[model samples]
Target: MTRTSAVSLIRSRTLSDVAEYAYAATAPAGSRLIFLAGACPLDEHGGTVAVGDYAGQAARAVANLRTALADAGASVEDVISTRVLVASARQEDLVAAWQVVRDAFGDHDVPSTLMGVTVLGYADQLVEIEAVAAVLDEPQPEGAACPPSA
Candidate 1:
């Protein structure tokens, strides 16, 4: 069976380093796209895991994002884009959170936006992230029956 992988698109004028976040993404046909809600620092017990610490909160949020993708039969490699939000607009805080995000994404080079905000949904929550992934469907053998969609 054959499957198509996601493609990252870049414009000629853009910096090559921006491959870390392609200006656009193209998913293969018949791919199953998953849109995840923003993930916070909530622990297994549904309580906030890291309070006041941006880096710690970022790590927990990234972990939660992985869990969410796994639940949808996806993985970090399938991610196409991500939006990262930090409670403070400070560069240091954004850097702290971005480091954790980079660690989580590894070499995948998924497109991402890192921004600072005045507040978040949960009180004391320093970081949150939302992601979109494309899980490609394997090509069925010729004449095989098609699988039903969920």
Candidate 2:
């Protein structure tokens, strides 16, 4: 496996799992790449976030994505593309859910695709997010600055 660093917004202050803090910055060259599968509003124990709440579902979806990225040695900043899924008939619900998704992905204006679906793998899951990211082997160029975190 390739050596990977954790990309985060806030550095851990204690010994317990510390999240790194990173701002908006370009990635290094020849970075390792990883694509994350679509993540739904499922908990670590295979539980649903919100049964019918779009916002809650969206939040969980993004959280799940984060976990997946961490497991794969990647971060939201590494993600370059995303596909968003929503299962709702009301446009308002979808818009609300999208906002949640936007907020979760650091709101860095990353590339994303939003789609309306009739249903998801789980009946209670109303939101799903999938993405592709590149993890750099080194820091940004000598003169480059890291991007601000969301």
Candidate 3:
């Protein structure tokens, strides 16, 4: 069996989550690391979840990240870091969006950063997110691709 851990690193209020910083850097040797491409606001059907809706987009992004993590043999608890990009200059909206992610990740840990981007891959997308997870296992299967679309 493999053991994993997470930690928090940021400390800010107002615009910050109550939990501040978090991380999951303690993994035994031979542990594998998974890097997932940024996930946008697209849903399983390849349709935008909530056009111009930052909070909705943020939730969808987290869901996609969770799926990818599971497929890669990791879990939300294994995540060590995350980068979130919101396509807007409104700091208040961004904070609300971040709250959605904070709720999804629960007590799991990871150091996370949020950014305000001018745009994303699609005009309908309001947010995009990427993550890094550490798992106790051999390397992932070579040439493995993302799970086939359902």
Candidate 4:
């Protein structure tokens, strides 16, 4: 079966030297939007994982993000935009986290914002990922009545 996503990424022709990401994204009407909570690098017991390691925390954060997306009936491919938070002043730390997230999305790179923050919610939490996704259902037959919300 063929697969489709609701988000359409937009690129600018004049900004060619920009990073490997879309400048913007749009979700058409009838698409179900999923706004996800920030995914943190926490373990099963609610404790932060990979303390003091940016890359390790980033990888865990990405994994948590995938799980959150699945629970929301979406995936990384359906993500329209993302905001990655790294608790550090160093660009290297941000890059370490960003590289993991960027590699996870691969070619379906959607619009993203990477930021450095002074702190995070959990103790020793080095990385967090917040995302918005859209789930699209096939268009109903023309003029068909809409289904009731659950």
**Local accuracy by lDDT, each model:** 0.83, 0.71, 0.76, 0.91
lDDT of model number 1: 0.83
TM-score per prediction, in order, is: 0.82, 0.69, 0.77, 0.89
- Candidate 1: where are CA atoms >4 Å away? 1-13, 16-19, 139-150
Distance (Å) between predicted and true CA of 71, model 3? 0.8
Residues 79-106 of candidate 2: C-alpha lDDT, one tens digit per residue = 7667788997788888888888777765
lDDT of 1 by residue, 1-150 (tens): 433455454444555754455666668777889999999999888788778888999999989999998787678888888999998979999989998998888877677899999999876788999999998766689999987544
lDDT of 3 by residue, 19-100 (tens): 5554324555665667889977787778889887789999989988888887877788888788989888999978878989
Q: Whole-model lDDT for model 4 versus the true structure?
A: 0.91
Clash counts per candidate, in order, are 0, 10, 12, 0
Q: Any runs in candidate 4 off by more than 4 Å, and if so which?
A: 138-150
Weakest 10 consecutive residues of candidate 3 by summed lDDT: 3-12
Clashes of 2: 10
Displacement of residue 36 (Cα, Å) in model 4 is: 0.4
Q: Rank by TM-score, highest first.
A: 4, 1, 3, 2
Q: Among these predicted structures, which one has the highest lDDT?
A: 4
Candidate No. with top TM-score? 4
Regions of candidate 3 where Cα sits further than 4 Å from its true position: 1-19, 23-26, 138-150
Query: Any idea what lDDT model 2 has?
Result: 0.71
Each model's Cα RMSD: 3.2, 11.8, 5.7, 3.1
